[model samples]
Target: MTEASGDVRLTGISKTYGSFTAVHPLDLTVPQGSFYALLGASGCGKTTTLRMIAGLEEPSSGTVCLGEQDVTALPPYKRPVNTVFQSYALFPHLDIFENVAFGLRRRGIKSVKKQVGDMLDLVQLGEQARKKPHQLSGGQQQRVAVARALINHPKVLLLDEPLGALDLKLRRQMQLELKRIQTEVGITFVHVTHDQEEAMTMADTVAVMNGGRVEQQGAPAELYENPRTTFVANFLGTSNFIAAEVDSVSGDDVVLRAGDGKLLLPKARCGAATSPGGKVLLGVRPEKITLTHADDAGTVPDGRNRITGRVVASSFIGVSTQYVIERPLCDAFEVYAQNIERDTRLTPGADVVLHWNPAHTFGLDAGQDVQAGVEKVEEDA
Candidate 1:
């Protein structure tokens, strides 16, 4: 697959079914030749957004532009886009070569045989070119579908959960293979998926959607490390959120008093303009916290946040220990500790303190409804 120097722009694009809205007005941009992902839970509009880009579903409003051309009114077959669906949707009687050649042949492309041969080689399936769709394994069928879409050399390749039918191991392998193929083809890929890990691992930029709208968009690491909304924080990874009151503000750091009386986070986590007596939510990743012995009140490191709790449960997970610690005021907090030889000891029903760097905590505005917010947190966790 060679990278296409084509970018896609979606401006206020939306779709509706009579009175019901499937995709709210949304805006997005995919850089030329980048592997972009539309990621979210089911019913979050990721598939609808992808369909709009592929011209399978017409937008109820706004325009879709591929590179510099307005394609809002173009039909799927006429648009410079091709889709590889979750089911592969391969012709049962068609062999690998035929499947790859289908698109080119339908368009009356010249040198179809040579193009199909090149596509088979591109996907590393040349040896199985004569095997029928039923004779190939799930992963191989998926590769054929990809090659079929690539044979047309479309400006943008749209994949709708293309690896959903594969097993865990195959899915992981395909994530890498998909990245390689996207790079080789040099075509901008617009992928729709509900798998967070998949989006993070394969996408150059990820658009996190919710309630038919984009909640946030950024590179995987950027969104993971500095999530602006509570939804983004909870959805992207495991996060423990503690409710707190702004006790005071000093320079760039805001002093917050957690419900458990812990006054530890620095201004870096709370932002620069938080005022005294304001309410905020503090988020801490499980991996950032450490568990220490019940009686050990070792000197807390400078610029570190520390709190004490009783270990309610502990589970050994080979490489690390997962501990659920109950705080006096806040809900239980989870901590993951590496099973390093000397620090491997932890037991349920023991009292222990959790410590993490202050900079690792993120302060969020306390405007969201507590019930709805908590539900999202539990769902993501």
Candidate 2:
């Protein structure tokens, strides 16, 4: 390994079959010793991109670099990378310890007892070393696969939906376990996942892919808080978009007209090209807005946006109550109010006002689809 050994870089990387392009030409750099996630729905080319890096599928054009070395033409075994797939491809006949040691033994490293033992302990499977694949739980089997890959000390560890097989509770546990292991090993981890929450929970950097291209790439917090595209805003989490006209732009602030009310948005936080009289999509997260009785709209604090609407529906989700408000500008605006102190009066069919600080609002291009990546209507608020 060189000084830049752990970094993975793809320059002008793309994949095509006959006529259909899977991965469009793009450049991405995964930093050294950081956990990176390629997040997208199926057929979005996330898996194809990963395969290109792993040398399983050759790119139609471009170069794959592991640190300073160009590994584009290198075979899977030749490249300093290892992959763990969703299916735990463990040898049924081999016990957990032997399965983990298989890779080392194949490389002709005979002194593997200590190394294999340490790895088993690292995955918290030391006691199950002698158990066969069938005897171990799904999570245990997955951990064994992880131990097997990590024992090789690859420059980059690629995990393609590695936790997709486990049940909900087990999947959540494995997510934390994988993060802890990555932190301890300090190897560059490039993860592929469709679950937004899973990607956000485990990855230090997340690249949201759509239409065979990366829509956005940044820290999970950065991307969630300041998404630049409609796809990103909708895919990462729920966003209530209201079509509004740009009222004016002054310094860093931009005012917009929604229905008969006005919304103040910060220009720095918006990606839409805004000028006076132009159209833009104003977005607010469900958790960022507050819901109160419609009669109390005038009591909202100065500088906060207030929109009155009739509550079409409300659902209690333990920690919070989600409300769907029918507004004039858009079909519905979603609001989430914490249940620390529930308001019994704010029920379905009740008129209410949604209010939030100006700083929490963002804007996007109005010409784009209002429901670009939204999964379902009437599911959330």
Candidate 3:
């Protein structure tokens, strides 16, 4: 393979079907041999974007480049890429060995024994070579699909919700398996999925897509820790946003004034309203907050935002206790505290104080919808 073999780049690429635009003009580059994931909900254009890169759907405009070659107008078979769909798509009559070897045989390549054997071993299915798709479990069948795709030695591999059909336990197992296979082969893999956890677990880089555009793209931990948009703040994980107005901005520190309390936030963490007197939303992750009794508010140390509220509800979920605290800044502020000591004082209707370091807080533009990523549940009439 050439030095640029595994890199995939899309420059101003977009797709539209009839009057509807599936993907807006966007530019993205997937680094060589990196595991990348396109994440979003249904109709968010993630799959459409992936298809454009794979040559399955022609882009309305822009160029698709693999390595140094412009493969924008190339067909799926002409591009040096392979795809694994949600369905394994293996022939029922073909055994595992034949299925994996089929790709090589179709390309008129003879003597595929070593190549087929190596791929099967890579996916940990060497012993199951003789089994048909129907005879194997979902996980095993999925592995066969992977082996078939990898046997061709494509520069890039695209997975479209390949593990969506498996049960939760098997799905989790395959996630690790896929990551391991990608690392072993050293091929660029672009994965498309709506599952946030799957993207976080398997990909080295994740691009969060919405409304035909990428909202943000970065390392999973980076995006989760410091989300710039309201959608990202709520989509990747649970975030409790407190409405506040800017009171003062000095150097790297910006003070926010909530109802009767003051929140000191780092300017670098503020997504908007860097100047004073502007409206903004202060954000903190559920796990980053510490809960204390309302009576103990005075005992809390300085440099942390301390606010008293009543616990509206709480669920003891084995690993941690999740609480919904009703406060003046927001109707419901979620908090997750580990059951290390199992504070019995925190109960429904109990008064408590929520405190966390100023550095842990972030800010977002208040003009955007407060509940951008909340799942909408239909109520029965």
Candidate 4:
């Protein structure tokens, strides 16, 4: 074995039981000094994959590589990785300082004063050094767990839903703090999570797994903007898909006939093969659409993909108002309009027009189940 270079490489890694498969054979790479997330719903094999890398769960096939060293047969203690789980697992009898110094003391390092002090300060828990684990707040205790894990200075840190125990607000705050810590420490951080927002806000790269397979992997923004599958579009966020047929192929644009209206889609944005009369699904995020009262429909700008519908419901959600419109082909056409101008007439039983820039629309293969990811996150959220 060579010195660990801090990169985690998995080639054809898989996990299986007697008859059921947890993680299918897949290849993944976590570059040195990067934050990577494996995101998926419960029972989606994300946890199994993380455990395999930690040596807690053995892979049915393939090898686990830490940099150039293959540590497939090594025990968890021998691998150059420390895992921070949802449970802090701190020793209740020890103070914060001693808790972080436990790893060093176990290794027979006699003098642990400077090392423990520095670790506490690194995690901003220097002031809480004398406090016991049971006495600290949930967030503070979590920090102690992280400090303890980092004190070992492992080549990689594996986090398994470390923010699961935190409330929504605290979880969000921790997301930024973890990202800050990762940047400061500059080591490979492989995080496994079911929360889409947590993964999006923290990880530099995210691999979305489903049904024992990795559906897609990319930057959060990249995945959000150009999802190749309906499952990805709906799972990451909400997407309103409109059924359409290719009217013709114009210069750099694909003319689509959606219901009674003609829509234009960018050639590059279409993720499906297009031919004259071929069916496709035109997808647009709710926030990308502008909803206007039918009485004021004429004011909508030109060169925009437009749809005529009736307001079925409306909701005010603090920053923006979400409207559900009933339209041809698709009944629940959703739109999120910023609270810029109040339109009192845009209510249930009111006529409305939904419009958005054509460039914001993406075309998907019509054969895919449009509801593939709809409500799937609710299972774990």
Candidate 5:
């Protein structure tokens, strides 16, 4: 086969146990040979969705199709898919080579040396072939697990938080490594992860799930830049939201009134209804904001959305100084200013003016809880 071809198509698929619905009826597509991630916090049904695709969990309704073939009723062993779990689940007694070769041997493929060697090289673990699972580092063991799964030439490979057992540094390294391997093999990859950065960094497309349904799905940049819900805005990274009332809407902009200030949101950037006098939540990512001491506030570029606030807390996180600012309407709003020029006066209690291009601002429905995705961040941590 030319690269284990087939788009994974889930149509109106869902799972429920007794009274509780683990995953609501949902339609999704993982493009052929593409890296797709099901991203969410615990209990969000990302894993349930992934399991459904893998034929490990039967859908309460609908179908799971790989290209033109309907595999909804197939058992896990019969489907053209393989799963790698958080636990490596390696045979401790076998060396790396045999572990990866086990599937080939079970299928009675005797001439497996070259296939096994090439697979090991693909994961950069050829040198570790003689070593047993315990002799390898956690990262190496995970790679071995991945190598073992991919060697079977499954049309789709499902990774269920495969790097969750590694340390932070190793997990991040594996993120890049996994992406590299996927690109090289050109196999469809369906990964389930709770780590926002991991999903953004490794997957070509990410489906953000919440409360058993997908809240948003798009390229990483698109989802991060223009989130449609408060949950997505707050959970994707960190978003600062100011409750506002729409004062007017012109050709390309919706003017909002918050406290004593007015903010401009580009019409295309707003995802909420913009009726005259309607309430909406104005949103901006922390990194999109620039903090200027109130003394130099007049120097900020014209037409930027500006808010007056005082720094409440500050922490130096190497690349940038993250600040908590308290303003009229919103409490504990965040701003991340890069460490380009130190603003000595931006310490706690110091008055500051926050400004950013109006185009960077997004609008969300104010009726939804502004804190929807906030606690999920802590839960994922």
Candidate 6:
């Protein structure tokens, strides 16, 4: 593995509880001072990996290195890492200043008052220094917890779903706050979250984990635009995956036939062999698809892929219209059209045509195994 400056390296790291494997052999490198996120659904080993890096849990095998130090066997307090847990984990009996000062006091640091004051000011909690944990709101209590962790000047700050307990508005606010704090302090932050939007918005890099291992790691846009695996494409956002067979290959672009008798030309350049009848998968984002009335006699749009379907459902979402269209050969495909002030909402039973730019289509191998146990849960209707 390539070693970057100020990087935290984990090589062949694994964790087990009795007979159950919590984290499979994992290799990861978090560059120094970068906001990195470990993202996955619950039980996907993201939390376990964060704990291992925080020194709260030891690896069953392999090594953990911080910068130039090997701290695999070090205890939480002994390692140069501090954690802000989901619950804030503040001391209820102590005021903001005292709680933030707790870590420094434990280390017998002199002039603890000045250090606490500085840390409190750092988090904009200087005026609330006298307030107890119960006297503060959820967001305030979270800031106190952050202050407490940072007072010790740890090299890496591990946050395990720290914003999970807040409401949507507060969570969004804190996400920006957390990113700003990281920038001002220039400390490495390794955050664990199952929220794709949260990870994409706050972290400099994202590692998508699944089934006890990281499936893909890259910048948010990189993962969103050029997903390496079907799991990454599906997990990051809404996508329409259509089964296809490669008809021909021209340099990087491959012409494939969708299961529904529609020809698809993908934008991706793949190394996979494409024989005349070889099968593949075509992935297109919901937002990339355009819906038109079935009888519209436009120029067929000169697209490499087009399919006719019946609109099964349509919902207005203020700025966009989401349509669920039933295709003849593939599963129901979803498309989102921008409102643009034109009344384009189709009736539920109306016939429609779905067309998308070939540049938006991506091709991948057809037979990759889907990660089954870590699927994200949809909100109740």
- Report how far residue 232 has shifted in candidate 1, in Å: 1.5
Off by over 4 Å in 1: 1-5, 260-273, 342-345, 369-381
Q: State in Å the error of residue 361, model 6.
A: 0.9
lDDT of each: 0.84, 0.92, 0.92, 0.91, 0.92, 0.84
Q: What TM value does model 5 have?
A: 0.97
- Which lDDT tens digits does candidate 1 get at residues 291-324? 8876776755656678888888888899888889
Model 2, backbone clash pairs (residues 3+ apart or across chains), number: 0
lDDT for model 4, on a 0 to 1 scale? 0.91
Specify the poorest-scoring 10-residue window by lDDT in model 2: 372-381
Candidate 6 pairs with clashing backbones: none
**Candidate 2 residues 1-381, lDDT tens each?**
566899999999999999999999999999999999999988899999999999999999999999999999899999999999999899999999999999999999999999999999999999999999999889999999999999999999999999999899999999999999999999999999999999999999999999899999999999999998989999999999999999988788998988788899999987787888888989999999999887677788888888889998999999999999998879688898999988888998899888999899989988888788887646664
User: What local lDDT does model 5 show for residue 98?
Assistant: 100
C-alpha RMSD by candidate, in order: 3.0, 2.2, 1.2, 2.1, 1.9, 2.8
User: Each candidate's TM vs. the true structure?
Assistant: 0.93, 0.97, 0.98, 0.96, 0.97, 0.92
| Shift in Å, residue 192, candidate 5 | 0.6
Q: What is the lDDT of residue 52 in candidate 2?
A: 93
Residue 266, candidate 4: Cα error in Å is 1.3
Report clash pairs, candidate 3: none
Q: Which stretches of model 2 miss by more than 4 angstroms?
A: 376-381
Model 3: lDDT of residue 243:
89
Each prediction's number of clashing residue pairs: 11, 0, 0, 0, 0, 0
Q: What is the lDDT of residue 110 in candidate 1?
A: 62
**Model 3: number of clashes?**
0
Quote the lDDT for 1 in model 5. Answer: 55
Candidate 3's TM-score reads: 0.98
